[model samples]
Target chain A: DVKVTQSSRYLVKRTGEKVFLECVQDMDHENMFWYRQDPGLGLRLIYFSYDVKMKEKGDIPEGYSVSREKKERFSLILESASTNQTSMYLCASSFSGANQPQHFGDGTRLSIL
Target chain B: DQQVKQNSPSLSVQEGRISILNCDYTNSMFDYFLWYKKYPAEGPTFLISISSIKDKNEDGRFTVFLNKSAKHLSLHIVPSQPGDSAVYFCAAIRQGAQKLVFGQGTRLTINP
Candidate 1:
């Protein structure tokens, strides 16, 4: 079984504040991803890391960035939190293969006021 | 442009009945499809998948049927249980592509 752990399950931040969402995987997968799940919009990818120090922007990358200093850890940074940024954030990891399934963490529900 | 689409936003079914969810994709380059189930406050979990070469794949009570000509796919859950109630998402990936395009998702509710 693969274990993907997020630093926080619930978060609250004020407008203009910076936010950090951390994720760690135990399986040492080479691929890590950050996504935001919204109603009627599905899971939109924010950022993804294929290897340590390598990152790529996904569909919705504005106002967000990512860090992959190590193979087991990936972090998402919100430069300036806003009310619209409040949503459920998910972290997933997978092996570097064509059809490999991604394992996900429980997710963090973020609230920006 | 939305590459993948789940037309049905929600579906309700009895515990012992069959529940069928449908998905469609516009991109013909997609060679692999996957289904995921997500519970409230939890991330989406991989349910089942099918390759373009195969039309059907079955696991336990869940089965996925794909129609390459129609560019559509469907998931059927037999003898649906309360535990099957969740948001189901359909995703697609091109051959050798690392990213997956997902549908909006369909919420399934099972009535006891």
Candidate 2:
């Protein structure tokens, strides 16, 4: 079984603080993704990394950036946390194939005050 | 504009009955479709998927039906159980594309 693990299950941060969300996958997949799940918006992609040091912006990448220094770990950085940015964060990893299914980690529910 | 849409916000189904969740997409270029199931506080799990070459795919109690002509797809859960209740998200991607577009999910409740 594939396992994708997130650094935190729940988080709280003050406005204007910097936040980091970490994810690690054991399956050695080549693709990693960061997504924010909202009530009406569902899962909106924030950033994705195809390989080490290679990242791409997704639909909702504003105020967020990503780091993929290693194949097994991907990190999402919130430049300046705000109340509106509070939401559930999900990390997923998939194989290189186009039609392959993505395996997800248990999400981190971040609350910004 | 939202490329994928799931108009129904919620659905209630009796246990042992069938539950049908529908999804529609406006992007004609999307050639692959997938369904994901998510529990509260958990990330969405890959439930099932169907490529454009085929119209239907089935796995045990879950079946995914696709209609390319209408750019619509549906997921059917048979003998719905209480454990089957969750938020279902439909996603699509164009062939060879690195990104997948997701729809606003539909929450399904299975009543015991």
Candidate 3:
């Protein structure tokens, strides 16, 4: 079984603070992705990394960035957390194929005040 | 513009009955479709998937049906149990795109 682990399960941040969400996968998957879930707006991709040091912006990339310094680790950064950024953040990892199933970690529910 | 759509926001079904969830996509480039089940405060989990070339795929109690002409897909879960209740999301991906387009999920409630 693939194990994807997020650093935190719930987070609280103040406005303008830089927030970091960490994710690590044990399956040695080549692809890592970050997404946010909102009511009525399913899961929207924020960023994705196909290779180490290579990243691509997803549909909604504003105010967020990602780092994949290692193949097994991916990190999502909030430049300056705002109230609007509060949502359930999820991290997923998959083998290097479009058809491969992506395994997800338990999400981190973020709250910005 | 939303490329993927789930017209129904929620569905209720009696336990042991068949639960069918529908999804539609506007992108012809999509070559694969998948269904994910999510619970509160947890990330979505892979449930079932079907290739665009094939019309149907089944796994245990979950079956996924795809219609290429209509650009639509559906997931049927027979003998639905209380544990089957969750938010179901339909997603699509084009060959080599690596990006999955997801539709607004439909919440499934199984009533005894």
Candidate 4:
């Protein structure tokens, strides 16, 4: 079975605090993605990494950065957490193919105060 | 603009009945469509998918139908059970692309 694990299930941070969300996938997939899900906005991609040390900005990448130092682990970083940055953060991984399905983690619900 | 839309925010169905969830997309270039089911607090799970070449695909009690001319798709779950209750999201991807555009999602409730 393919499993993706996030570092935290729930987080509360103050404004201007630096926050880090970690993700790890056991399937050895080549692609890793970070997304923030809002109530009516669905899932908005923040960043994605196709290979180690390679990253691409997604639709809403303004306040977030990502790190992919290893194949199994991907990290999402918030430079300066703001109240608007609070949302359910999701991490997903998929193999390199046209018809591949992305495997997702449980997600971290982050709240900025 | 939302490339994919699931306008129906929620739906109710009796057990053993067929539940149909609809989705629409504005992007004409999307050739691959996927459906995912998500329970509260958990991530979405891949349900089924269909390619542009095929109008319909079925696996067990779940069937996905695509209407290219209307830019719409639907997922039919036969004999829906209480366990089938979840939020369903429809996503689309263009040919040879890595990113998937998602819908706002529709919550399905199966009553016993």
**Residues B20-86, model 2: lDDT tens digits:** 9999999999999999999997888999999999999999999999999999999999989999999
Interface RMSD of each: 0.7, 0.9, 0.9, 0.7
DockQ of 2: 0.84
Per-residue alpha-carbon lDDT of candidate 3 for residues A16-76, written as tens digits (9 for 90 to 100): 9999999999998999999999999989999999999999999999999999999999999
Candidate 2, residues A1-113, lDDT tens digits: the string is: 99999999999999999999999999999999999998988889999999999999999999999999999999999999999999999999999878988889999999999
Off by over 4 Å in 3: none
- What does candidate 1's lDDT look like per residue over B23-95, in tens digits? 9999999999999999998889999999999999999999999999999999999989999999999999999
Q: Which 10-residue window in model 2 chain B sums to the lowest lDDT?
A: B93-102
lDDT of each residue in B13-71, candidate 4, tens digit only: 99999999999999999999999999999999999999999999999999999999999
**lDDT scores for all predictions?**
0.97, 0.95, 0.95, 0.95
* Per-model TM against the reference: 0.99, 0.98, 0.99, 0.98
Off by over 4 Å in 4: none
Residue pairs with backbone overlap in model 3? none
Candidate closest to the true structure, highest DockQ = 1
Candidate 1 reference-contact recovery: 0.74
Across residues A1-113, which tens digit of lDDT does each residue of candidate 4 receive? 99999999999999999999999999999999998989888888899999999999999999899999999999999999999998999999999889889999999999999
Give TM-score values for chain A, per-prediction.
0.99, 0.98, 0.98, 0.99
Q: Categorize the docking of model 1.
A: high
The per-residue C-alpha lDDT of model 2 at residue B97 equals 80
